[model samples]
Target: MSESTTPLVWLVIRKDDNGNRYRIGSYATKAEAQQIADRLDDRGPKQLYWVERAGQGGAQ
Candidate 1:
């Protein structure tokens, strides 16, 4: 196996009523992801979140 040191990106997902998560996109920074979520304010009722992998540099 190969070691991956590259930081994991921030993932934006939309959750459905059935508890299904749909991936939207991933960003290298939390700010970028939050910006997207903010822009989606007028879209509809959505379960939005910023997810980062372990060892990734981002706000906890």
Candidate 2:
């Protein structure tokens, strides 16, 4: 498939204590994004990590 046609449907987002959100990375699969988010979440509790659809509202 072409790069433009391949959808990056998964987004890994991080939110800090100040309530600011950032898009850490994008992945073609939810499982891949979730694994990265889970690993980051485990490293510390100061920040929060989660996965959502790319255009849903979590992150862009």
Candidate 3:
């Protein structure tokens, strides 16, 4: 598929106290992913949330 037609996914990542990181969710847009991250971040400081763009090959 062409670049323009290739599906892009924005990931909301969470890092825990033990330094373990994983994907919280995948969104079609960065704004959506950021929203989720921001909401989760406001819960507390124990865990950190951030948004990242998935690689073209679907890897983080």
Best by TM-score: 2
Writing each residue's lDDT as its tens digit, candidate 2 over 1-60 gives: 887787888999998888889999988889999999989988966688899996699532
Runs off by more than 4 Å, candidate 1: 1-8, 45-60
**Reference-based TM-score, model 3:** 0.74
Q: Tell me which of candidates 1 and 3 scores higher on lDDT.
A: 3
Task: Give the alpha carbon lDDT tens digit for every residue of 1-60 in model 1.
Answer: 233654546766656778666667776677777777677744767555455543454343
- Rank candidates by TM-score, best first: 2, 3, 1
lDDT, residue 16, model 3: 83
Ranking by lDDT: 2, 3, 1
> Scored by CA lDDT, what does every candidate get?
0.61, 0.87, 0.79
Which residue runs of candidate 3 sit more than 4 Å off their true CA positions?
1-8, 56-60
Per-residue error at 47 for model 1, in Å? 4.6
Question: Which wins on TM-score, candidate 1 or candidate 2?
Answer: 2
Two-way lDDT contest, 1 vs 2, winner: 2
Any runs in candidate 2 off by more than 4 Å, and if so which? 2-5
Candidate 1 residue-wise lDDT at 28 = 67
Residue pairs clashing in model 1 are: none
lDDT (tens digit, per residue) of candidate 3 on 1-60: 776775658988887888788889888789988988899988866687888888643332
Worst 10 residues of 2 by lDDT: 51-60
Instruction: Write down the worst ten-residue block by lDDT for model 3.
Output: 51-60
The per-prediction CA RMSD against the true structure, in angstroms, equals 6.4, 2.9, 5.3
